[model samples]
Target: MSNPESFRELCRNELHSGPTSGLLSGYVQANLLILPQSAAESFEDLCFRNPVACPLLCKTNDSPYRLENHDRYIKNGHFDIRRDFPKYNIYHGGELIEQKNNCVDEWAEGHVGFLIGCSFSFEYALAQAGLAPKNVVQGSNVSMFVTTKYLDTSGIFHRCPYVVSMRPYKVNDIEQVRQITRLFKKTHGEPIDWGFDGAQRLGIRDLKQPEYGDPIDIAENEIPVFWACGVTPQLAVATVGQSIDGAVVGHTPGHMLVLDTTQVS
Candidate 1:
């Protein structure tokens, strides 16, 4: 499962359905967000307003199930948006209604698919620096939390909290981790904050209870490090509430779509 094409085939055929971290190393991974065509423009504006959490890679309004001409990021010709992701979350009226292995039955003609930059894309570089995330080392999904900090609002999108992914590191190793991750500008560059003080600044009360993904145990000298997460959009959609007329689709937390390109600059 080292090759992106082969890994994608497993996803397409429903052979591999789990968190995508630590697999397909050296390749870029993306978070999927499929929105109704009517709200696509506003949602794009939201992404523009909040680039750290939602750094958009590429988007298409042509086909909901496939990417025909977009080869720069996703080089696989057989890539399908509906079936390539390990899991999908379906949201209606700002509430998650169902989780599915594939979105083949949920996607429609006017749906727009967006590929957002994921922090998972930068994990390979961290491992290269001997700062691999504990979640990757433990074979679990990264812990994610909805912070009290609010994102700058766009048209029809408001009152959304900034979601952050957490990783634990020794107090001394945090500086090196920050230095290494800062190079990945496209995939949530650097740590927004580290240590327990950092978590409090973001209004997170408890580290044990995460909104999404698994919680990793923190060692004696280690502290929780937080980063902007792609799941912010899913929270945004939920916070926006009844403003959206139709259902929204997104990749499940920690599960991402692997792209062929390795360039994150």
Candidate 2:
């Protein structure tokens, strides 16, 4: 087995750039969050309520930046959360902003850490179904968008809308797409809706102007399909709670936490 800490150091050393899609190969990459104790309980409840966006993979018992993964941390003497991740986004007073690679100094004992399953888990399932993602198709990041919809009331997070990712495919491939992704319920299960009409319902109108990822052409006989993206929560973290009254705190959209688990298991 490879030394996870060494890999982390290497990622930080030089190659720790760009999308990590094919880098880890089979690891269960995750969406991350570090919130104050006041909102942690509500956030967890929101995650449980809307399992699609917030899968609720794992959480730390105490201050976020200071996590004790025991085994992983022990195995690597240098298991510092701040510098470990290639990048991070900082959310303060509900506003978000990108931070340099390290944010450990900003950590307070009151913060809590959260990790959620990512759609990356189903990449194999997607490939197995013969419907490899187009983001992977065009060698770019996945396209994401914010929606007007909101999850049922839970707490501070209940007011946000579900974010979604769009992929164009032939009508013929739709069935295979469903059958394959349906099996990965722990991840983002079957498509919530299909075709361009559904895409519009999700607040993603421009196929060419994706918030992320390059636009892939839609075949004359095909339509754009939508999936309940895990990135939804991240987008919420990035866009929610921003008011024009001099309150614009937010986080970056694409950055996610990479988990210690691997999909190749």
Task: Give me the displacement of residue 232 in model 2, in angstroms.
Answer: 1.9
Regions of model 1 farther than 4 Å from truth? 65-69
User: lDDT of each prediction vs. the true structure?
Assistant: 0.86, 0.63
**Candidate 1 residue pairs that clash:** none
**Residues 165-224, model 1: lDDT tens digits:** 999999899889988888888898999998899999999988999998898898998899
Highest-lDDT candidate: 1
Cα lDDT tens digits for candidate 2, 75-139: 43545554555666666545564565656656656666666666776766676566788767677
Candidate 2 wrong stretches, greater than 4 Å: 1-5, 11-17, 63-78, 238-256, 263-265
Give the Cα-based TM-score of candidate 1 against the true structure: 0.91
Extract clashing residue pairs from model 2. Answer: 26-263, 27-262, 95-249, 95-250, 96-249, 96-250, 96-251
